[model samples]
Target: MTLFELTNSLKRTITESSYGQSEKHKLLQSEYVSHRELVQFYQACNPTPTLLSLIRQTKLHLPKYKTYKQTKTKEFLKMMEKLRLEAQEAEYRKLINPDPEHTTLYDTSNQEYVSPVQAHKELKNQLTTIVNVFISVGSVSYAVWYWTASSWGLRDSYRVLLTVFFGLLVLVAEVVVYMGYLNKIEEARAKESKKKEVKKVIKTYDLTLDNLTAEKL
Candidate 1:
C-alpha cells in the first residue's frame, strides 16, 4: 500500500479498536513508554515522516528515543573529556622532556627551521669575521697608499689622518647597522615565544552518528 493509505488505515484501526483506546490513553498519560508498546499501539507503524508526526502530536516519549538522545549527549561529553586529558598530558610531557624540533623556529625567508639561539650566535660570528676582513684590507690599503704618497713627495699627514678617521667611522656605522639587525631578530624571537605560551590550541571532535547503525548489513 502507498504510505498515505497505510497511515489512514492505521489511524482508523486505532480509533475503532477497544484495546487501542486504552493503550492510547495510557501512552498519553505516561511520560515514557517502551518502543515495542508504541509500535504495537500504532499497529507496527514504520515510523516514516507521517508516523513520526503523529507520535510528536501525542507528546509521548519512547525509552529508546530518550536513550538515543542521552547516548549522543554522553558520547559528546566523553569525547570532550578525552580531548581535555590528552591536551593536559601533552603539555605535561612537553614540560618534562622538551622536543628539539619544537624549540626551533621556522624561518620563512630561509624556508627552514633554525634554533633562535644558534642563529644569533652564527650571525655574531659572521659579523666578527666580516669586520676583521674589512679592518685587515683597510689597514693594508692605507699603509700602501701612505708609502706611495711619501715616495712621490706628495705626503700630507693631515689628509692621511682624515682618511683613516673616515674609514674607521664607516666601519663603526656598518657594525652598528648589523647589530641593530641582530637585535631585531632577538626581539622577534622573544615576542614569538611569548605568543606560543599564550596561544590556545584548538581541537575538534565529531559528534554525529554518521557511521552508526542498528545492525550490521
Candidate 2:
C-alpha cells in the first residue's frame, strides 16, 4: 500500500482496536505514527502490519526499545511524583489560608509576578528616566537653536522670550501625549489583569502512570 493509504489504515485500525482506549495508544497516535522516521520505517516493511503487531514482533530485535521503555518509565514516574507533591502543597495552602488575599500581580507581557508596590516602583523609575531623557534632549536642542538664531541677527532678548513660550508649548504638548500614553498603558494593564484573573481558576487533572512500553514503539 502507498504510504498515505498505509498511514490512514493504521490510524483507523488503532482507533477501532481495544488498545486505542489506552493513553499509550493515544500518545502513539498523536506523536509517533505520523513521524517521518517511523513512516519511513513502516515503508521499508515488505508487508506492513499494524503498529501493535509490528512492535510485538520486533521488540527483541530492537534493543533501543528496552532502553527507551526504562528511561521513559523513570521520567514518567518522576513527573507524576512532582505533580502529586505540587497538588498536595496547593491543598495544604488552601486549608491554611482559605481566603488568602492576592496582592501580587502577574505581568503577562514580561511573564513575571510582582507585588503592587514593586510594580509601582518599577513604573515610577521608568517614567522618571524617560522624563529626564526628554528634558535633557529638549534643553540641549533649544540651546543650540537659540544660539544659532542669535548669531543670525535675532535679538538676545527676543530669543529669551521666545524660549519661554516655546518651552511652555512643548511642555503642554508633552503632557497631553504623555497622558494619552499613560491611559493606553492603564487600559492594556487592565486587560492583562483580567486575563490573569481568568487564568487563576486552575484546572485539576487526574494523572496516572500509563504503560510506557508503547512509547518505546
Candidate 3:
C-alpha cells in the first residue's frame, strides 16, 4: 500500500475504536487509592496529563473531589465494623497466646540511641523514690516520739488514746503520699513503654500540590 493510504487507514482504525473516548468516567467509579498512597499519586500523576486521563477523566477535580473521605452504604459500613471487631478479637487472642515462632507484621523501634535527658529523668525518678522512703521513715519516727515524749503517763487514758491516734494519723498520711507517688511513677513508666513499643508509621511528604491546582491562564 502507499504511505499516504497506510497513514489514513491507521487513523480510521483508531478513530473507529474507543481510543479517543475515556475508558473511565469523570468520577473515578472503579478503584480506590489508599490514604498511604494519596501523596505519591498526587505528586507523580499530576504531571502526566495522558496518564491521568487514562486513569480517570477527573484529574481536574482531584484536590477538591474528596480525596480523603469515603462514603459507604449501610451494608458496607456494618460489614466493615464487624470485620474490625473480629480483627480486634484476633489481636486479643494473639496477645493471650503469642507464638514465639510466628513473625508479626507490626514492629517496634529497636533503636539503641539513648538521650541524656531521658537518662537523667529516669535517675531523678529513682532518687525521688529513695527520698520518699526516707521521708516516710522519718515521719514514722516523729509519730513515735510525739506519742512517747509528749506526756504519755501524765495525760488521762482518753487523752493518751487521742494523742496516739493523732500520731498514727501522721504515719498514715505519709504512707498514703508515698503510695500515690508510686502510682504516678508506674503510670509514667507504662506510658513511656507504650510509646517505645509502637513504631511510627510514615507517609509521603513534601508534595507538589501546585501542579494539581487550577491555573488562571
Top TM-score hit: 2
Clashes of 2: 0
Each candidate's clash count: 0, 0, 0
Model 3 scores worst on lDDT over the 10 consecutive residues at 1-10
lDDT of each: 0.60, 0.57, 0.52
Report the candidate with higher lDDT, 1 versus 3.
1
Order the candidates by lDDT, highest first.
1, 2, 3
Per-residue CA lDDT of candidate 3, range 1-217, in tens? 1111113332333235343244213112233433333334334434334434323422222333656777799999999999999999978966864554444475423332347898898799878876776666566655655656565644455555655566567667767877898799878866775662444658765456674463423
Candidate 2, 1-217: lDDT as tens digits: 1112224445554445444245325434442333443444444442345545544332122123544444568888999999999999977865764433443464233344567998999899778967875795589559856675967667777776667766667777767777788799889987875663222647865454454555555
- Candidate 3 local Cα displacement, residue 113, angstroms: 24
Residue 134 local lDDT, model 3: 64
TM-score of each predicted structure versus truth: 0.32, 0.33, 0.26
Q: Is candidate 2 or candidate 3 better by TM-score?
A: 2
TM-score of 1: 0.32
Considering only N, C-alpha and C atoms within 3 Å, which residue pairs clash in candidate 3? none
lDDT of 3 at 151: 58
CA deviation > 4 Å runs, candidate 2: 1-117, 120-141, 148-151, 196-217
TM-score attained by model 2: 0.33
